[model samples]
Target: MAYEVLVQSVVDYAIYLLDREGRVSSWNPGAERIKGYSPGEILGKHFSRFYTEEDRHADVPEAALGPSLGGDIQFETAVP
Candidate 1:
């Protein structure tokens, strides 16, 4: 499908979707490359994995999702 094409072809941006509970629902090739997680390994996992340990300890994941409940959040970061 065309949706699949655009999402999967991205290479510089980590493109993916999260469920209501912040679990990865869909993953793209760029997400795999940038975050080091293949869909098989990361799907259904919490987005907390992308946070630093200190951030996790600070409950940053939950806080980060609060403002974006009904919208999109965009920021640029280098992931590896």
Candidate 2:
């Protein structure tokens, strides 16, 4: 699909999709490069895996699923 190609071709930003329950469902090449996890390693895992320990302890990942004023959800994380 054209969309698949576009997603895979991007290398400057990490782009991915999550399921309704916040599980990683689709991962792109950019995501693999930026996040350092192959699809095999991260698919089906919670998106919270990218968050810092303090963020996880604070439930920041779940909170990010909430509606946002700008109509876009974004957050930063410290990746290993």
Candidate 3:
């Protein structure tokens, strides 16, 4: 629970929750900062909004979620 709260307080990385149906069930300050959307503006919206228009239209957002939820996705960050 405390971890959840800490994540909620973040202002980076666009943290969010997607239900089984792939709908956004929650939004956090980080989401607002990275996505330019406030919680009130984006809650209940599909998590695909973070993708480019072409990606969304091609369902690439769904594809990304699949591996992520399956624990087969890995993210690497490099600092320049």
Candidate 4:
């Protein structure tokens, strides 16, 4: 389907889905570029792996998700 092809071809932003528990459920090429993780390496892993240890330790990662899912949070990071 065209939708599937479009999703597969995306390379700008890391397009992915996470379960309520924050585990990575899917990944695309953009995810590889943004996160330095291959789909094979990241699938089924906790999305928190992208966070710094201090953030994870403070539970900030989990807190951020609440706002993000509610459209109350917007993240802007420089990738380079």
List model 4 lDDT by residue over 1-80, tens digit each.
88767877999988898987888988989889988899889999988778777767876667768865774654443223
Whole-model lDDT per candidate: 0.84, 0.85, 0.74, 0.79
lDDT-based ranking: 2, 1, 4, 3
lDDT of 2 by residue, 8-70 (tens): 889888999998788999998888998899999999999988888899998778878865323
What does candidate 3's lDDT look like per residue over 1-80, in tens digits? Answer: 99788988788677888887677888888778877888788878887776767766776677767775774544332222
Worst 10 residues of 4 by lDDT: 71-80
Quantify how close model 1 is to the true structure by its C-alpha RMSD in Å.
Answer: 3.5
Off by over 4 Å in 1: 70-80
Question: Any idea how many clashes model 3 has?
Answer: 0
Cα displacement (angstroms), candidate 2, residue 26, comes to 0.9
Q: How accurate is candidate 3 locally (lDDT)?
A: 0.74
In candidate 2, list every pair of residues with a backbone clash.
none
- Give the CA lDDT, 0 to 100, for residue 66 in model 3: 70
Q: Lowest summed-lDDT stretch of 10 residues in model 3? A: 71-80
Best by lDDT: 2
Between prediction 1 and prediction 4, the one with superior TM-score is 1
What does the lDDT read for residue 29 in candidate 2?
85
Worst 10 residues of 1 by lDDT: 71-80
